[model samples]
Target: MAFFRPGVSREAEVRHHADQEVGKSFGELLEKARGAEHELRRTQASRAGAAELRAAGLAFDRALTDALRAAEAAQRAAFGVKAYDDRIRRRKGVATPEGARWTAEVNKLRTLREENRLTGIARVPRPFAPAR
Candidate 1:
């Protein structure tokens, strides 16, 4: 601390006041930097969460498409038609149509959600053997 000397001019007091103001400004800057750091962390976390959701959406979409394809194949095998014809439905009991059964199938490789909704073949699920 600079003691006030009898000879010290008024300029010393002015210098001391200026220094105090500058110190206060530095404290405010420190607070602002801390706030900015906190906000950056929060933004990063939100971005990571969004990325995971996008990945899940992609996974769900792929599973649904695969399921639809499998269900179509099962329907073809069950009803002997690539497309469901009403004539067949009228002749065969409603029980035979592929639409009446399996809503979802979960396997290790892929989740067969749509295939499960497609038809009866899922009910009698045969091990998926690659086409001979």
Candidate 2:
């Protein structure tokens, strides 16, 4: 039988997909934050003048705060969970027919394997197999 296995339900699959999308968005936001941090660091390191260094330091601080706030908001909006909270929960559920089909396919595979008592099947013959 195939290695495919019964998995999450349709509702669960939808929820999982949504969660993934939100995660990607959150990651993008984090990348922006990192860029801001890099800029701030560069400004501070430049030898142009003292005034420039001070300005850069201030901007860096503000950028840091903005990044943190953005992250918090994204997390709450995406997963409906607080950054400080130990546990997070999703507000939505999945609903996809494909999920159901996949689950059924997995169950069928499992049933076939049990009945056949087969470890595995391969198209290519083993080294010890007798030549035709």
- TM-scores for all predictions: 0.31, 0.34
How well does model 1 score by local distance difference test? 0.39
**Which is the leading candidate under lDDT?**
2
Q: How accurate locally is residue 114 in candidate 2, as Cα lDDT from 0 to 100?
A: 43
Instruction: Give the best candidate by TM-score.
Output: 2
Q: What is the C-alpha lDDT of each candidate?
A: 0.39, 0.44
State each candidate's clash count. 6, 2
Cα lDDT of model 1 by residue, 1-132, tens digit: 889634434564454444344434433443443454344345455654544444444444444454444543333334323123345543353255343432222131133343323420112335788988
Q: Cα deviation in Å at residue 94, candidate 2?
A: 21
Model 1: CA > 4 A from native = 1-48, 81-86, 89-93, 97-99, 102-132
Candidate 2 residue pairs in clash (backbone atoms < 3 Å): 11-94, 15-94
Instruction: Evaluate model 1: give its TM-score.
Output: 0.31
